[model samples]
Target chain A: MPDARSTPVTAAILVIGDEILSGRTKDKNIGYIAEYLTSSGIDLREVRVVPDVAEEIVAAVNALRARYTYLFTTGGIGPTHDDITADCVAQALGVGIDVDPRARAMLLERIKEADLNEARLRMARIPFGAELIENAVSKAPGFMIENVIVMAGVPAIMQSMLDAVAPRLRTGARVTAETIEAGNLPEGGYASDLALVAKAHPGVSIGSYPSMTPAGFRNQIVVRGRDGEAVAAARAAVEALVARLHAARG
Target chain B: MPDARSTPVTAAILVIGDEILSGRTKDKNIGYIAEYLTSSGIDLREVRVVPDVAEEIVAAVNALRARYTYLFTTGGIGPTHDDITADCVAQALGVGIDVDPRARAMLLERIKEADLNEARLRMARIPFGAELIENAVSKAPGFMIENVIVMAGVPAIMQSMLDAVAPRLRTGARVTAETIEAGNLPEGGYASDLALVAKAHPGVSIGSYPSMTPAGFRNQIVVRGRDGEAVAAARAAVEALVARLHAARG
Candidate 1:
């Protein structure tokens, strides 16, 4: 393969579930996968949460898989009828799906053959030519077909599957980040100067985040880029700006 | 207006910020909005999180606006250079955007005239022919153009803006949800039966969510529908199934 650091790797996450849309379940997988990908040198560009409708799942899988280097999907891969992600992926890729021997073996590790009824066998269904991703928690393996990686909705299983698949992925240069505490200095006081510094530094992305606290507003400015030197330069500029504003107020 | 009970109002949330995508910030809005809309008689059907890039924001705005009854957006409305959501929404709607007198007046409530520099004025920019959504927490306002409701990224301000705009929105019948705990009941034991219950109740959507607990798996079956009777019936069926499984285990 080409040098991992020289290429750009991007990813998108598709969360498939009605529970999330109904607010019956709060999604914990998206943020976990995003942080995991970022630390692994892959940039997560977008995320979409769609209901467990087959058509919607297929469309999202096709769209995201085509747009990014990899598409990671969580949810809708269980034993119930609502778990249609595998069928949707098969339909999206125009491939056949059936109970894979490898996946069935994984399921057998946790379940007896007599108890593996039709509903349980559903967990063994994988699209043709897809590789099974180990779920160390549940033993119901996730799968990867082409650029799409399908994982379980349960956080522990999803994390285990991600760890199982991470080593095989192509990664770009890891992005470095620096956070500057803007504290009580309002963004309005420094936005103009920050814009100039941002314009001067083309590659780095700088963001100002403000949150409400019991005391007042607490603000943080983060600078990030694949080039460590560029990130450091932007951080210094932001630090200088904050110090100058603080001195003026004093 | 048509009878609110007879109509189905659907919405999509478009979160615009690179901080969320980079995993620097975990989103607190999607779940809050989902629950808010669910209780307010609006169905939140989809959610998309995109970066601060202009084209991506514009495309997402246009696409979601066309597909849903209401498209709600958060983030990128601040004074900094990355705050380009207003411009992108204007471009998406093919409308002109500039500093609105009404919004500037709102800002003047919190900012003195001498301190209202160019950067602060950026927050006052609003698209033409749009109504302002008040932000009680911060004086800078969000706006609504057609079906799209733009709000601030901060949780407190976004909640305020959502409350301000909720009165004007056309809502459908409220969806009622019922959750049944399936303690120690493996999904494989009841997936088939639950599928039957789901099929029998056509209008209701049923989902089984299993999460790993310190001791074992804790699963919940959620039944949701706009019709109270349907939701209750599905919930009863799920409850009976769980009880039957528990008895068999004993």
Candidate 2:
């Protein structure tokens, strides 16, 4: 449906948990999801982490869903008192929630009927007209409502849920990137020139990351764009500039 | 400034980088900063990750600074082309940015005058009328403008910077927490009773975290509040509920 000069498909990740805000749990889901979406040709533009509060979740969900093509939320869907993500999501979408037959079927495959206490049944709750995202780690499945994909907070389970929903997403052109090692050259030596190159190749996003390596603080300049020619041209310009600066030092 | 009871001081962290958005670097600063601020009695309620764009940085700085008592930003402070956090911060605060004499003095503690090239000198730039947050790990310093504190992305350097600013912050009453181990009980088994416990102790924030340990999916309930007595009371109720459930199972 997009024209030749189509913009990239964008997504935002919302991480919901009190444990994370409290610094009790280090989140592993955001990075994993960012990498996965990037490889799948989706641009992850923004990420937010909020505590397990109903109003907070609803506000964030509404804001991000309206802004991006998709919004992925992790955590707070478990069978506990603090796991209010589902109810909050339902309220955000203005949809009534009940135990979905598909989700209950998935749970019944792993949990016996006699063992299906109210606690385990809590995982089976689904928003109106949502599709179930299968969880291979545990039988408790995640669900997708409209443009938002809700998944588990645990790394292993979220990965499985992501795999289940990947096929349904509308992908875009994969971004092409080229990295030029600036050796030991300080970024300040070529910052102005790099800016000129970036201006010249407006399509390519040129970035410089400095690391304190054994050789010293080495700068790595990266140029990324959907157009291969633009990315490659920017990379060549950066390399040429760096070579000039290094020679000037000699 | 307060007569008797004071409102809790809240904070937010803004993580800026293209590497994080592109999925090349997994973020380590948010968790470290979140935990550090929590122990200091500042509630880290929101966290956002945005790319190294000046507009994005300025927008986040403005939003977070206006909303929270303190806003901490990590990344984009290095001496590289993408390290525009200084300029962006100045713009956000509506101030001029130039090389700070104090920061230059700190850099001179390590590097000689002749060796201090423009790239290395980039680290000395600070917003107008801002306080420097010392980085003992490295010679480069971070800075604070108004309520927003800017620090490094590297864990060691950020930790040292946090220590420098920790003493200067207007911290509120420290949150006290009590944790009760739920043994091998599933959270679903006690979700309802836990909700009741939470309702009765409205002052305390009770949270349930489920993790797959060697024993299995064990629930760890944490009760947190500014009032130690309230936290302790809620924790006792959770413990009693777990003990009763265990006895019934036996």
Candidate 3:
């Protein structure tokens, strides 16, 4: 077991959008960010999707930012009346918000000053004492206040914002995983054996997932851990168990 | 504003899975249920996704089930060792779980008795005193305890389970909405006007979303409310604003 790090870096994602909660939009950002954070060695422990309501957003932001090493929020940062994530984040941190010069400069790169109306300027309103997270796709930069990092809800922009912020994030040991396909074998046939394997490889996290499609039930087992040695050992054990099951059936 | 229902019925979704958190699977259930619940007059207030940890599932269940009128959970009910949603749910409700004869009978309709191994039998486990939600896609049944409805993570199965449980839920007045597309008008160009419209339509929720595609930026404005009159009124105002912007450009 690799317990090298005394405290592992962790994060929680807060997806703020009424459209998402109302089911008008299928969220693509959560999976993208989750995979990115996992690969970057930041444990994405929790994700909460709240509507555009200010109170709900504030409460979630406060709770999540306090618990996780970092809090990443997507959505509600647009130039619309319902876009209140910036203000809600300010409320959560008890900081005043205004149109920051840095963010305004970035916005100007896309829109001329004459064309920058109130709605467009809303995107530039940054919380006090926050660092800008450059939006490479567009000019409206996301900002990081304390431990909370806010980004666009749109998949493409959110991906760019994540890439910009990832370099500065405090990361821990990345988890490594191995998968073993348990073709046609019912989980019931190998459930007990899998549990025993899990018990033996206490350091690795083992999971079995079954999907029933036109082809029928397809089962896959995965083992994950930070320690490469532990993951390899668990993979070997799982492979042996599956091989034994195959032999018994034959 | 339509205040037809004295208190609106609300719901929260608890998505439990390791594959989803690992980013290996893009969640399709949340959006499906969100749309389903919205049309059924159940306001989906919040959504939380957690890993396959027992304690995390228990905590999320306790928090969400306490706050919302209904708490729907998806995933972790399969016939695998990692499928602990049933047990964790029981722990959250302070109840015991066992293989229910009703669920087993349902399972037997599909699987032969000889093939019903321990793993397959695991799927029949339900929390004590809970009502079973039928899975039309498969024989495995989901159960509802108190306000919590547990279902399969697979999109097809989850939809069937939700359909089975929706009729029994205490739903409130359904929300109606209208959409206004601002094809080329920049949100910044009319942001102040949009805010004024939002203030006028306090009973309705107004939102603007801008997307930058290969063609260019496309903006969409949506107005939503439980009141037919209020929603219509907001829609008219948004249409007029977009029209005025068009005239100015001409």
- Candidate 1 runs further than 4 Å off: A1-6, B1-6
Better of 1 and 3 by DockQ: 1
As a whole number from 0 to 100, the lDDT of residue B3 in candidate 1 is 79
RMSD per candidate (Å) reads 1.2, 2.2, 2.1
Over all chains combined, what TM-score does candidate 2 have?
Answer: 0.93
Off by over 4 Å in 3: A1-4, B1-4
Candidate 3 residue lDDT tens string, A112-157: 8888877788899999999999998877989999999999988888
Provide the lDDT at A163 for model 2. 96
* lDDT for position B114 in model 1: 94
DockQ scores for all the models shown?
Answer: 0.83, 0.64, 0.77
i-RMS values of the candidates, in order? 0.8, 1.9, 1.3
Ranking by TM-score: 1, 3, 2
Question: Please, what is the TM-score per model?
Answer: 0.98, 0.93, 0.97
For candidate 3, the per-residue lDDT at A3 reads: 57
Once fitted onto the true fold, the runs of candidate 2 whose alpha carbons sit more than 4 angstroms away are: A1-5, A213-218, A241-250, B1-5, B115-119
* DockQ of model 2, rounded to 2 decimals: 0.64
